[model samples]
Target: MVSPLFITTFTLLFVFHLNHTSTVRPKMHINIYMYINMCSSNILTNDCLPPLNDENDFLPPLNDENDFLPPLNDEIDFLPPLNDENDFIPPLNDENDYKKFAIKIPEKWKKKEWIKWMKQTEEDWLVFNTYIIKKKKKWLARKEIKWKNWIRGMEKKWMHYNPHIYREFKSNTMKKSQSWDDTQWARWIETEGKDFMEIEWEKWIYQNNKYINEWIMNQWLQWKNKKIMQWLMNSWKCEEDEYWETWERSTIWEKWFNLRKRRKWLRWHNRINKETDQWNKWVKSKEVIYTKEANNKLLEWINEKRNSFNNWKKSFIDKWIHKKQWIVWIREKQNLPCTI
Candidate 1:
């Protein structure tokens, strides 16, 4: 959209320059006049013009999908396909499941030491079994003593009221007592004397250490394996955690070193400035004032409600005392009036 005046001025300058040069060389006059007319016509048509594409739009259109190379299918599954060899999760019952916990095995003991440890564990297990047996025996002896005392006490209680019943009970208990096992006694109590028995003798027998020891012995191996597995797992986790901590600390140290080389002073100054600004902002904040105002209003509301309730209660009690003339209120309330 060039101004017509600008175009006319530019044409006049071109013609004047050609005329001035032609006067010095009349032979070039015709050629110069033809060149001027050609230039003037090109300017009028606006054909000898600027480039079609701007600097930013200079590149050809990218219509090829291959040129853009659809961003690496990031969502595609990269994991290995499921198979029996790789698909199985290590089960707690699997013997090989203990391997995840075996990371620190070498750190804790050498091959020879591990062998010694195994031998020691075996010995300890045997000793523990023997101790458990002894404990069971002691517990059985204690239970027998307690059972005898309980029987004696029950008999004594009955002796004061019914000597005959106590005598019969005692006789039955004493008869074949030396040959009577807990199971036999249990059978006798359930079948013959269960109705007469005051105490739950069978329950007491089951609670005895003998039965408890039997159950413990049955599960001992599994329990030991679980504890060893737990120890191994904990050791492995602790080692792994220590490694992670070391890595994190080293990373922080390197970061701090790089920071010191670049903007340590700037960071420190910014931190101090931020802290001061935060303190000032806190001092100016209306949150504390608003909270206090809300609390005051809440307290006032609570006091008003309490006073209103107390006044209502007082008025109700006064009316009850003055208006209700019931002479037997206590008996009426209990609903248990006595008849004369």
Candidate 2:
């Protein structure tokens, strides 16, 4: 027979297990509820119960879902209000007793308070000015270091390729030869002109000179654009200071001006008003002009090349064979025995 103590202990364990399982796994909570009902029914029937050696032997493992517990309701009340009759006593001092929460002081005290406020303001302004100066100097020094490093890097790259002798020499010997000299130089200009007419040669020379001039113009425009961009970046920090100017509020204006109008003026003054499109327009116009000029120059060069080629063909025929010589050469080619 099961003892009374063992039955009570098993009942307590079942209650605790049910309460814990109800929060973790609701589905297993139903099984535990049924098991609890069986235990109670057996107890009522005075059924004999087996002794449990361990809590685990009495309560089986539940499912693994760990649902959140419902939040507990707070039961404590807030602090009670103070009874004015028992706790609070009205002040019995005069209006000028130096304790009233008012901004307008008696005329006698105004001078002393004004001097104290002015002294504090002067100290604050001096500290702020010193900080601003230090910050500006630090920012400028950092930018100067970056600029110097960039210049040093560029110089290193330039020095790697350029010889120091070029700097030492002053005459034309220091200058590099033109790129075209590597191609035709003296041979083509001297030999090719012998067969061609003076007019044809003059036309070619003029066309070539025009091409060189157009190339030089392109290089100049590119260099000008780079310089402009560099200068703009170097001066960028100071370009918009006028737009950020603050409007000083005089005592009279502060007292009389509407708050809404003052706010509107502040908003307008704080915005950047400078037009950035002027530089964009200038760059666009320059690009369009350069593109058009380059196209025209290219077309002229192509036409000149075609004309020079035709002139060379004509001059070659004149220098070599006339109609009879050409016919004789064709007959000899046709009469030659076939190698096959």
Candidate 3:
């Protein structure tokens, strides 16, 4: 039911709009207000038709399953260590597990004295084994040192061609203009246009042997000055640290009296029979087979092979380790004097 007055007024406005506008203008312009209202109502009632994929629209959507992720796993996550549990750790691994120590006394034998003996024996065996290990370590260390010396000698021989490498190093070291005071410092301009003085004494001067020596000297002088002041004040007690006449005249008090006594006794004991009695702290040096010694020993052996009597004597003293029929040979040749 369009009102005739309203329709007539709209037709007159449309004609006026056409007369003012260019050729691009349409004959009539639809009222957007009424069209928008109508379209919205139809959509709400599904008369305009819903989205094609309305089923997906109702349900929730999922992620791509390969989107931006958080931080990944670590080594501890895959194979958690044994200590991850609250239990205490067990005993150590041993290359040479001497079963003698591992041997345990039976439950029935626990009452016997052999149980205690076994424990003591095991401890003693362990101590003895360490001695063997130390000897082995010493031997290995000596061998290593020898090889090192040989390598060092070769390096030195090569370096003789040009000794300037060390000189160049020294020059580079000297070129760094930083003095002791300014070694850890840098000059900087301040915000106020003045020089900034950042004195980081902690990082600048670390505790070292040189500083220690200087400190000790300063301490000694300070102590001496204090003592002199006390003497001048006439307040120096005779027995400042002891029962005495004057601090200096009193019974001599040695800081290392006990230490001196121990050293004196130790030195006196050292004068006694040393070869059999002394347990030397010095490790016995390795006896490396030098070329001269090896050659001499080899030549003597070869010479002994040539001599008729030496040959016969050598047969008797022949190494039995390689001989297969050694047991039978020993029985048949009973008179053959054993050399080993």
Candidate 4:
């Protein structure tokens, strides 16, 4: 039930208040590009204003129209090919470049390409070589430190418990002993003469010379024997030994002479009978004893013998020899056939 004049006056007062407030408040200087970027496509309409070309705007200026366009095919065609060999390898003027080149070497490169890539100027080669030498030294130093630490750890953990380690240590000691020259031997004898001589004598007493036949056949031993004969003749010992009959000057000599006589008799017996003596001393010295390689070789020889025996059996059966002497042949060749 409001009057028309009162309604008109209220409308005019509201409009005046809005105008006064707008004039009194500070103007907001928004970037036109920012507004465009933030404004959603769905909300943009014909009512939206065009962007202003204000130089003082806080937003960056727009690039030209050509900047957004793709390059022409003709322009690309005028440029060098991307796969050019020269373009692939950048110049290695410094150590850093050399390292990078070495690290980034392509797996698929041809030998020729690799050679070409590796080729460098004298100055560049020096730098590269220096870098490589330094790197290798550092690597070796680190490796040596790691190896020392590992050895220390192993020694602490298994030095007393491991038999293999003890054996290896003994083998190394033997090698070092065998490698000693006259001076080193003299020095060692000076320091540990009694203990060393005792150990050596014990070993000599326990073990016979396994290489006696080889030693007898050695040229140096033959020369020494001739010299000994000359010395014996000059000293008149040869004349004195004429009625000795046996070279048994001492108990040791008599024992060795008896052993040699027995061995010679056994060897003659074996040759005459064409039978092997199982207890022959030379059998142990032969390469067929107590080693992995020897065992393998023995197995192979046995297999060959077995195969030959089988072939011989087949032949004997075809020839009707099996009917006549089957049991005898089988008994003779049961262990390892001499004929087959």
- C-alpha local distance difference test of each model: 0.44, 0.41, 0.32, 0.38
Tens-place lDDT per residue, model 4, 1-340, is 6565564555456445544443211222233233343343333444333334453322322354342233445322223444654554667687555543432332223223323422422244355436544654564456446544643453243212222432433333223555555455445334443243334333432332223223323533454345334433532223223323233334665545455333333333343233123212322333232234434543454455446434543453333332323223233434434343
Candidate 1: C-alpha RMSD to true structure equals 31.3
- Greater lDDT among 1 and 2 belongs to 1
Task: Please give, for residues 54-104, the per-residue lDDT of candidate 1 as tens digits.
Answer: 343223334543332233332212333334422423345543444332332
Residue-by-residue lDDT tens digits, candidate 3, 21-89: 422212112332333344534322332222233332322222432222222242121222333222212
Candidate 2 per-residue lDDT over residues 1-340, each given as its tens digit: 8875676578769678556653324544455566556565555343333333455443434453221212223211122333432322235365433222121122223233334544554465356436544654564456446534643453343222223323432322213333333233233223442332334445644664565446545654665566445433422122212212323434557534545334433433332222234344545654554466645754565465557555654554443332222223223335753332
Global Cα lDDT for candidate 3: 0.32
How much does candidate 3 score in TM-score?
A: 0.14
Ranking by TM-score: 1, 2, 4, 3
Q: Which candidate should be chosen as best, given lDDT against the real structure?
A: 1
Window of ten residues with lowest summed lDDT in model 1 = 101-110
Clashing pairs in 4: none
Name the better of 2 and 3 by TM-score. 2
Could you tell me the lDDT of residue 36 within candidate 3? 34
Best by TM-score: 1
TM-score, predicted candidate 4 vs. hidden true structure: 0.15
